[model samples]
Target: MKVDFRYLGRSEVREIAGGQALSFAPNLARSKVFFDAEIVHPLRFREAICALHDVVVGDLKFKKKDKGAYEAWKRDQAQKQEQVRQTLLDQARMRELAAVVKEPLPKNLKGDFQRMHRLYWDARNKWALELSRNDPELFRHLVPCDPVVTVAPDMVFFECFAKDESSYGFLGVDRGAFRTEAGAGLGTTNVDYSLALYEHFQTLRSYRPTRLLVDPSGFEVNIQGRTDYREEKIDLPASWLRGFGQLQAAMGLPSRRFELSVDVVYSILAFLKRHREKAGPRSLRFQLQPGKPPTVVLEPWGIPIVSHGRAYEGEKAEEIKVWGRRRLAPLARILPLAERFEVMLFGSGLPSVWTARMGEMRMVLALSGWTANDWTRGSNLDQFFADLQADPAAVDKLAGHLEQVRMARLTTLAEQTNVPRSVLMGSLHELARRGQLVYDFSVDAVRWRSILPVALSESMLGPEPAELVAGRRLAADPSTTVEREVMMARGARLVVANVGQSACEAVIDPDGSLTRAKCGCSFFYKNKLRAGPCRHLIALRSVARRSVVATTDRSDLTVHLMSGTYAELRAEADKRTVATGYVIEHAWRLAREAIQRTASLADPTQAAGVYRTPAKIPQSLSLPRALVEEIQREAARLDVSVSVVVEAAWSVAADQIRKSSSLLN
Candidate 1:
């Protein structure tokens, strides 16, 4: 039957196991096994507890003593119960349970409740299988076994039968036991415990545990919005959890992989073998002997000894903290989604013991955690390089984000590729000049703000047009439009002679050198290359058309030079050159001369002083009142400033009259 799986926390486990005082059922009987129409993993906890009860299990009883202590405990328990009741009452007041109980599990289905205990183990085993089979780079030596036993938050045991497989069949007297005619190899450490457990099961005639999965589905699960229940909440072995976290963190790098080739597996095994040699008893480091088979022997390091002194035939093995189990568990939930990958094995930060399976091959791998975050966080040089080569769009997006996040400087894009940062910087400069990408020193990388070419969003798709980018929109009376003004003020500046709204002229400073030049065009911005003027130019052309239509034609506005007028025009040209920093080039001078011959009159002085001035007469103030009155009366006769009246009224009046004549006349 299909049932949504969930992990059962300690509370639910305790409740179903019979709240502290409940005793195991008496006279428990063992039942014969039979294959069902549908075969599924049975809840092992119930079977184990029932088995213990059936065996008369040494009559389990509470060991806690001290009457006063018990009394205090009872009082605390009562207070806790009251608190729980109050909490439930509060929740009820909130009226949120209507949604919860609306589609609740069937009542009195205790078997379903018992199923939750299996979820944690199931997830772990399933995850292991997935990695072993799919992730050749991550789990090269992981092997599928006949029986997998799981005890939540602590142990997971997998067994493979040797010698006699029939004795280890699901049923009969030998039930689930491998009858090895030869004793288990001496010096085998944890393998002995597994073997012993297997042998004990045979004595009890119990069925083989094909795979022990702590199914969490049978629990009273209240978790909402969780599609993948195992990752939502899981209780895994502490060491395994740590390994999972490291794996997750490491797998984020898309380049990381557990190489599956036979040669790679053998090399990994060789690495592990060398590491195990010089490692002290229960210590985690090994020394590497150079020049011979690339030997790796352990040296004294920070590796810890977790479980020790339990080995078969006087051989001892310590439970090495392979990976940071605590840190890795959470990461395992997300590692598969990472963009890159790097394979690591036998490192100081890695798990002490790990078996990877690559197809038919199985071996151990080794690594040093000295430079681990690179492999773990998707910043691995190899991964970055590969991404740079294969998928530029994704790389650009990632780079842009990293730059935005201010990690671009820290990003070793150059190291990933042979390309130099100088070359990249030049390209970036060109792009920035073209207004394709903007660089902020406060930021780490160039930010991609889609300017110039309008982004086609859903809203834009439906709408006529939008003023989203930085530019001026031309009005119906285009003569008054400020497109040219806006471009001059906001766009990248061009060093040119005779720069005007129409027919702007400029020469490239370094001939044929396109590096520094930029065009304010949609194509230039979008493509990040210096191309000819695009849509912006077309738009400007439209604006120019309107200006031409609204303004007076300049065809007859010039004056031809004749004899004495030539000397005056020469003087005027000299003065214009000094004022504007631009001497007329040969062609421009010839064109100007031609235009002057065609024009009958010179261009007016652009309506001098268009700005309005104050109409009232001005007066200068003095500390003395008598001096101020004299100055005011003097200003009244000329209707001018006191300073103007005192300094030189005639000259000031002549200048004012010339300005007015220049303006209105």
Candidate 2:
């Protein structure tokens, strides 16, 4: 994708009577966005912006040793030898010429040559420095894009992705922190940023007053003859867009959230600065338990740094390990101003977010699994969103609504749209994946912030993995059959499936991570999960998901039939009726009539309560034999009829479903 940025003038900090004015020139090619505010905490803002700049230029990937260095060394040695030989030859020739012609050579010839050589080098160095000053782009080839700034009603934030695509930064200043001077427009636009601007930010101090401006007046002024007018056109790679989307999506997923004191962060950084590891298992392990402070154990050396923050309120104990600890260096500078650090860990070998909180400002640093495992190439993280089927229409509807509100919680969005929370979640994920929205973990709400002027399309995210594509095809084929599924303890499942010509078996853990997989295909025999799951494994997973969905639908129907009112049961049964061609309503009517006829068989008082038609619906359901026997035993123990036991069981199941679904909100 090609993006064009035209700035009226370079962003600079200008001296005023009592303070400084920090003016930022935005991309005029995008929407006209402007904000002018008097900064309450200039030093904090400056450090946060400087930290963002560090992320913009940071590249931590290990580079191989360059062969050109050795070549240059060889050339230097050869040149020295040639110079020595030439000097010897000249001296011998000079002796012979002195014996023959006896004319003295020019006295100042060697001195003059030396002077000329020094002058030439000095002039060349000056020229190169001048050229670089004239064209800053020559030095910024790696940073193809600039930081994105969004001005919303609640706050203003700047977002940037690292050149290496391994780290992401978000710095937000709440509106309460800034006193608006002028211009209330709200939108997202690129700002002109450079190393020069970062240098200017260091001059900010608490003693001096500073005004922050996202200057839109640049768009109004004529730039026909302006000397500072400049334009840049960058052809951004697809991986850049894909990485941004992936990181945004990852932030919205459920994670283990905790808080750390500023002192704890300093301790971690201190240890990292002193020691260097040159071995395996370089990770930061988090030992968490309910009602206890978290302990962070540094790997390879087993050093522990316990936090002094509040106790963990999670239900269970867990140990999560995260990599890419070195990327936390950028946060060291802003530590003094930060009050505390909030961290969200998705899982071990997954992305994590660390947020530095000031009074009303936050600096967020999101790192991938490791330096080499960038967001774009993390297939394991990508699998989380693979099965999420997003409805385009619903996504558009939610996006339009969010645009007007600027920011909202998920429940608020669902209530307004009148759509199911599950479907709305998929839509919200779709919006986030396209870079149209950002989930703010601090507030647990989503804000409208478009990373690009235009929404990224599916093509811009690159193609799906070849294995996933082939697996989808196989799953859709009629020949593919799920042979057996054995329910194991602790929500685990053992699945066997015949995909194409191969028989595959896979063990899926409770958390959906693949524990074991085997297949007869050559792809599996060669690379196995190193190159991701084979097509057969993917097909088996797909078939297993379909089977689970089918079972869930039946279970949901049973819950509705036993506990729901007449109207609710009719609505749910009508949906199943369409698919199975069963006259569910007529079946219910016949069952009710049969129960009335058999009223004489039971106690007259109990029969009146069992045959009530308002709350309970008596419909024939094919339940598991074990469940039926359990219900019978419960009824016998309670000294009640089977109908009463069924109704009580449905109420419990419905309550559990409601509780589980509340987690999504």
Candidate 3:
């Protein structure tokens, strides 16, 4: 089969890297070549294959910059919460608080309730004290310091380090136990089922034995001929490790109990009964009206409700009590104020149960949505497995249009193409990473096909013409023209300081114009500007270039973090202007300059044989005054050239200090 290649624009080209480019290139021996004067075209089949390769390679293209930013944000949020904690500590009457109440009451509570506002704030913080204060969403649940713990199936525990008794540290577990079994195939168990019940005495001394959630279907207790034991036990899956730990942590506290009204409690039981009789998994979404003439609406996530009124109160109350006692006993102490709660059960699989604690009441939630395979229509092949499925031809055409408009999304393409949804999705993803196709989120399926750039079938059947190849090669070389030169200047600087092997240096003239540049990484030189530069280029340019600049004695060069234990320095850096290795080097150089001034004054020969007179080291540390004044006139310039004046003054002052001190001595 013959394969052709399509050229991408600057923005579209940037998404892919070198590996994808090579993958998209034709295998001249077996495949036929294709060429176009302005734009090259290849067969859709080969394009699809090349696109797939591109997608795979691109997926691995980790964006370190984005990752670093996300980590920094997490750190910043933690610090901000600490600040809030400190402010709260300054307030008096910190003790005897239940929960902090927020404004905009449940559209009901009367006048006297306003006094409890401060109490709400204290309770919210109390709940957060047990959990890590780093998470704000969880922290909100703490009313003034009252710990609000969320109990579920797979819970584990962690002890808090701080030990101030009144400081609101780890008190004790109130609800369920956290368990880990010792058997194979445990990893396949559902996350919620793996919870262990926590048994807390009035004291913190003795704990009880906990049972892990096991598959009811897998419960095989056969009678051996004689006195025989069971073969093996099962364990929880590795995937549930995090959920298990969190669930256990919730148990390490005194339980905050609430109750659902008798009517509301009865309604929950009726819904569960109907779901038990139903075929597949069933869900009920309900809204609770707290005050006068209380009413609850039982809404399902998908299936329509046949009857909304109360049922099973007289007839099924006993059965409900039995099941509720077995499953709801742990939560029995706190069921009175359950305003709006949801419960979900799986016929044969793992069941997840949860209750969200709002103010006095809690709303329980369950995972009710169907699995991916259930939604997939294998024969239809056109619609996607998401909430909405569209026509296949429409999806492919949409994919084609996204390619023309230079958007990226094979999943969306599959939805549009109506081809086997999975195949189109996989293929579209391939094209996007290879930088051959693009996508836009704005358009519908019909409009998507309209946007793609047109490629004729005939244009993709042969070798690329010599003229086009030569032009492309020329475009890659930045030294060829002013436009290319400017583009390389910007890209070179961007990659110079990245954590990569390639390093490029740009020379700025006195007028602040980029005069000349060179990059050893070879990316910019090779005429490619996609997927940023490799890590090697970043290291060479950033680490190596900064090293060179440090030696240059430039006044603007700052010291920064090169390498060290983060914990040892993180606290100090927060207080004293934290920066990278480059900034740290700059600070050191400044100090060294001060030392040099003292040294020169102490030397007889350097001091011109005069005891108090200081010799000068002439250095033009800043640009000329005219250049500075010119930049000052431009509002768009980020940096003004006034730095020269500051440098000159600092140099003169250093000499003056040396002379005065020498005279005094």
The TM-scores of all predictions, comma-separated, are 0.18, 0.72, 0.17
Give the Å error, residue 489, model 2. 9.0
Over the stretch 1-665, how does candidate 1's per-residue lDDT look in tens digits?
Answer: 01111222211111122111111111001111111011122232223322222211111112356699889988988798589788988988778767767787878677565566567667666786567556632332232121212111111112221111100101111112212112111110111112233233322222422322133232234546543233221121122212212322222222211222233223333444455434433223322222212112223434322121111221222222222121111112112222222223333333222233211111222221322221112111111011112233433544455334422342564554344543443333333322234322211233332222222222322221122111124222234232221111111112321112332322111111111223344443553211122223323333433342223221111112233323432443344322110111111222333222322111111232122233333221111234335435644644644433222322222234323312111
Candidate RMSDs in order: 30.1, 11.4, 33.1
lDDT of 2 by residue, 28-91 (tens): 9888899988999898899888888888888878887889989999998879958978899999
Better of 1 and 2 by lDDT: 2
Best by lDDT: 2
Off by over 4 Å in 2: 67-141, 379-382, 455-457, 486-537, 552-665
Model 1 CA deviation exceeding 4 Å by range: 1-665
Question: Per-prediction count of colliding residue pairs?
Answer: 58, 0, 100
Candidate order, TM-score descending: 2, 1, 3
Residues forming the 10-long window of minimal summed lDDT in candidate 1: 164-173
Native-referenced Cα lDDT, model 3: 0.26
Model 1 quality (TM-score): 0.18
lDDT of each: 0.27, 0.72, 0.26
Error of 2 at 540 (Å): 3.1
- Worst 10-residue lDDT window, candidate 2: 577-586
TM-score of model 2 (CA atoms):
0.72
